[model samples]
Target chain A: MEHYNMNLTLKVWKQKNTNASGSFEIYQVKDISSEMSFLEMFDVLNEQLILEGKEPIAFDHDCREGICGMCSMYINGRAHGPWEKNTTCQLHMRAFKDGDTIVVEPWRSKAFPVIKDLMVNRSAFDRIIQAGGYISVNTGNAQDANALPIDKKNADDAFMAAACIGCGACVAACKNSSAMLFVSAKVSQLALLPQGQPERESRVLNMVAQMDKEAFGNCTNTYACEAECPKGISVSNIARLNREYLSASLSTEE
Target chain B: MGLTGLFLVTFLIVHAGVNACIFINDGGATFNAAAHFMSHNWVIRIMEIGLFAGLIAHILQGLLLWKQNTAARPTKYAMSAANENSKWYSRSMGILGSLLLIFLVIHISKFFVGTKVAMYADGGANDASHNLYLEMKEEFQKWWVVLIYSLGVISLFWHLLHGFQSAFQTLGINHKRYTPLIKTIGVGYTFIICLLFLLMPIAFYFGWIQ
Candidate 1:
């Protein structure tokens, strides 16, 4: 209901491509509305960059809504900015003071290499999901959703796991650079449901193997992933993942 | 670490029961016979092999896991900050586990491997129950040995407090509803096991209830 103008200084990362050595370039922005979303503030900065005949900072964005999760930024040492359970795009300028210094950088991971200024290649996540995520279901064999009769508690848990948007924020926030939370959420989502029964063994085995191959670190339970997750995905999902992986490993059938 | 860790949990229960025999009938024939069975039985020899295997696996896995953990965060944080969110034991598990591993090497080398070597060298002097008991008593008489064992047990207790529930959680035996209970069991089991084990050497050293 209220708007206030603010002045901010940013030390932003600028990279030509994945192979290029990047450095921080400083920029100053004045008279920005407090209600502007973090991305909108970036929009204002980019507008200034274009007017000065400089290349506008290249960053990823699509829906601008948090659901798409295209926006990624490590702001002031915190992934996805300073807010809890909110993505960079959803973060408002109001969260900061009138005069503040914001340090913006791309997600740092060998697997997620820098594509440009603030965009990194997150295709590692795609490969992890592709390894084994869905069960092969025939289109013609339509059955009632209630036919399986999943327990209410299990169903709720499954839905919670499914909330993950594959944002890569968990990986960014982790101190060990672990993707256990993401991989676990994906694994737990299906493991809790009857539809996932057929491919359960292979799904866990393949996904975990893929995760390891991606050079993701083992979880040390720092819980920074949960703290930074926009969807509020829990670290408990990783515990379930460990269980599933061990069970799959022990199963004689597979 | 999985199989070895679970085996160690089992070992804790059995080891506690064996040590509890010291209090049974106040060091009469019953306690001596239990100690004799543990020392001389063929079945226990097989179990000792299993125990050694468990210890090796646990240590190797811990080392591998710690290596991977370090690789993940290759860069140190520029600033010092306390993680107010996580449990202290969870954060310090690596350090505590390393200390426990060091203690394990010393413990097994001194008591386990030492007893075996001494038994073979003396041509059965170390085999008899009364002799074995005297050897143990003599070992405990060293104040430095007692101190080291005390520190080892304290570190072990800390390690178990986190490890017990963590293994269960990793195995997926934990749920939101049951997690609290598992945590309680973890802490309680660690306290009891360490208390019981530490009491034996201290009791022997102080000449309290030997």
Candidate 2:
């Protein structure tokens, strides 16, 4: 692949802390290689900032790969830049031109407030998960993996739903800042499995209550969460979540 | 919201079907007969009560949901650009629904209230002589009324375009094979239903029907 070096301008969000008023700070970096990942480019800029005795931009990132869900940059009005189904860390510099002025900010949602520059406190997700997102089993030695004899379709569906990494991109992308997709993905994964049957009724109810308590918006069925999901999580999981919630709410005997 | 939305969808079809009776060009006789039947039949009358209740519940729930959604994001983004992520109508249901609510009030007053008044004056539902078709004709003759009705139908068109498939999705009827079919049916349904409703006033104003 052919590579080119480009000088670019970045307008990044800067704040001392969550309570501080924030603003965009523009920094020009010369000779940015097109082959570098988006975060690598940020690394180059940070190195320059530190050498000049300035505080570098603070952004959340663990794996340079897309799996960790730690990276949460909203670039140029998108959750993860211009590419579809691409994470911020996975976004390459090639997507931008030499003279591009990229504006980078943190995920904007009430449930995921900014902690610092381009880093939001996503612990609400952990709370939502803690509410129900687990299965209870009796204490025993490990059973054979094939003992369950799960249906192939159900297994595949569960696998797909399980792929959610708890990224807040779905909330960032939604007009209402809804977390339905993330909650639904978790709900659907458990709902499809036989192991998740014991607490099935209470599980959905508890998780959804937690989600509501966190002040995340209701799903408007816009499907934006699915579109921006780096894991390509389907909105059908949300449909499943709705199904679960409605059934749990309506059932009197359970 | 999903349950009531589906109910309203069914109601729209029956309502549109009755309105399509205007296209028969029978000088409003067929339309009046259908309207009278709808008002007089016990089952239909009972369903009408349910329909009204459903509509009220739907509206109240929608408002509450909108309030919660708005409060969820206390702070707005400096640069949203939300249209890049979702359809305009999907994000604007509150506005579209409010428009429809205004239209509904005008519509029910013109026909439903008139029918009730005539029924009471005649001392029974069997003897009520109000001609709703005539009221529609007179109303459509006013350009502003027709314009308002047109705008309402336009809003209905956009609302149905988003609501139909969304209702199904919320109900968990989504499937790889059936989803595309549902979406196609949704598109066709929206166009046909809105066009049928739109034709009523246009036909009255243009003298296509008596």
**lDDT for B96 (candidate 1):** 90
lDDT of each: 0.81, 0.90
Those runs of model 2 whose alpha carbons end farther than 4 Å from true positions after fitting are A138-143, A250-254, B121-129
Question: How far in Å is the alpha carbon of B134 misplaced in model 2?
Answer: 2.2
Best by the DockQ measure: 2
Model 1: per-residue Cα lDDT over B1-210, one tens digit each: 545677899898987887677665364455557766876789998998888888878878888887886676553332222253356666677789888878888877876676576557668664553444555678889999899889989888877877887777666665778988988987888989999889877988998765
DockQ, prediction 2: 0.65
lDDT of 2 by residue, A51-141 (tens): 9999999999998889999999888888988899889889999999899898888888888888999999999999988999999878598
| Top candidate, metric lDDT | 2
- Tens-place lDDT digits, model 2, residues B1-210: 878998999999999999899889888899999999998899999999999999999999899999888887776666666677789999888899999999999988877888877777657654555788888999899998899899999999999999999989988778899999999999999999999989888988998888
Candidate DockQ scores, in order: 0.30, 0.65
Summarize candidate 1's per-residue lDDT along A1-254 as a digit string, tens digits: 67899999998889999899888899999999999999999999999999999998999888888998788888887778877898888999999888898888887776788899999899989999999978888767778878779999889889999999988888887766789999999999999999899999999999999999988877766677888889998878988898888888998474
Best by the TM-score measure: 2
Per-residue lDDT value at A202 in model 1:
96
Q: Which residue pairs in candidate 2 collide?
A: none
lDDT of 1 at A77: 79
